[model samples]
Target: RARPGLRVDAMVLSGGGGEREQEEHAALTAFCPGAELRLTVLKLADGRLPAQWEEAKAAVEDLRARTEPDLVLAPRTDDAHQDHRGLAKLMTTAFRDHLVLGYEIAKWDGDLGRPAAYQPLPAHIAEEKVRLLQEHYPSQRHRPWYDREAFLGLARIRGIECHARYAEAFAVTKLTLDLGD
Candidate 1:
């Protein structure tokens, strides 16, 4: 979870190209009240392909150039969704020296891979996260796999992997520890 005092900035690349984009904005605003939110709604006509990989990469590169954040959270490279995979791969180049955490999004594609990092969530925080997702994205609720069970079930599985009651998993391609810095 992002601490309230921390400055959090998020860039939402695609948003299903409609009301979902607006819903995402609203949800993110509520989730990170004081954080900076950037939404780029692109036309992804094909679910399996992105509009333009070079353009998306350039956009992300611009964001990185401007923000130069200490950490970046992006979609996992092996995500079943091609759009996500493309962005994830591009992120590796954009934030080459930064700590990037690849987040997993549960979907019907069922492409969950073994994650190397675990961020344990408190019971209440996990419940709240599920509740927020359900509340914020009414359009996604119609999907069979978008229910609480799927969300909580994946969290539970990840928790088991990390020896916690509830947790979120991330793929870490690289990391640098400055223990004595």
Candidate 2:
């Protein structure tokens, strides 16, 4: 059966600042051009982890109630940060049937684990991905780990794991495979 087209809903449970959030939204739009986009901006502070958990979880549940998504890109449950882990748990709870791909955020904490799945990107597309991040998210350029080399290097490493030229990795708790009947 032919599936529905892409409709992506990105939930920014907590943002660092207004400018950062704007940059992030622009970057996401550039990356996923032509997709129906629904973005929720929650400007909760990092210090307020407890509050963020309840509010973000409730928002996720509410969104899931109204929309049926084919795929969900969320933070993994093994995420080092409290906010990310909490959000991942809630996303898993809310999206039991849907395909939930838990993505990674490479940071200094050394939390990168062996991802369970991989999606290969073509050479041109992978190059474009790095270019978009550098162009759209200028605010993040100051960060030590935000350079193009760092981004491409990680993609290369993940690609090596999956035997692709470039790839994004994800943690999958459960997946149903359909062998040809």
Candidate 3:
């Protein structure tokens, strides 16, 4: 359950490809049949993203040409992984008009770029979220928690800046606000 003031309308999966993506999409849909989640599997060949940067860009451009959303969430360019950086730039170029936010998965060195928005979770929620990640992403069972928790912990710590107990971080590309004043 979310906080009293929090609300989630829909979930969209972007830039996931390969067996892991397919399996995760199926499981997500099954777990939340009524959630109306749209999982779009980008054509990039998984770990081969850096080698096919232009292709990924074209795929995102196609996504932009076909659909539009008020906001877009993508991988943070701060990542050490070239794939993450490519996807981040691709999303930024494709959804130029929407709020494109980046989500980080902590990597070596100083997580590349900095993020601006943080979405906090309760300690309990954070633990549960990590559990879910471990359970669903068995392919990552071998990797150390630093790759995962470091990311979430950053969110939690960043959230603390905004008075949240725990949270997720995002980098926005564009944002529009209505001035009621």
lDDT of 2 at 35: 71
> Which sections of candidate 1 miss by over 4 Å?
16-18, 43-51
TM-score of each: 0.88, 0.88, 0.75
By the lDDT metric, which is better: model 1 or model 3?
Answer: 1
RMSD of each: 2.3, 2.9, 4.3
**lDDT tens string, model 2, 1-181?**
0123467787776674687688768877887777777777777786566666777778888889878987888889889988888888888889999888999887767679889999988888789888988899786678888888887888999999999989999999778778988
> How many clashes in each structure?
0, 0, 8
Q: lDDT of each prediction vs. the true structure?
A: 0.82, 0.82, 0.65
Question: Between which residue pairs do clashes occur in model 3?
Answer: 78-113, 102-171, 119-167, 119-168, 120-166, 120-167, 121-166, 121-167
Off by over 4 Å in 3: 1-18, 30-33, 110-113, 146-152
How would you encode candidate 1's per-residue C-alpha lDDT over 1-181 as one tens digit per residue? 3565556556666565688778877888777777756655555444644657666777788778777777899998878788888889888888999999999988787889999999998999889889999999897788989988999999999999999999999999998988994
lDDT of 2: 0.82
* True-structure lDDT of candidate 3: 0.65
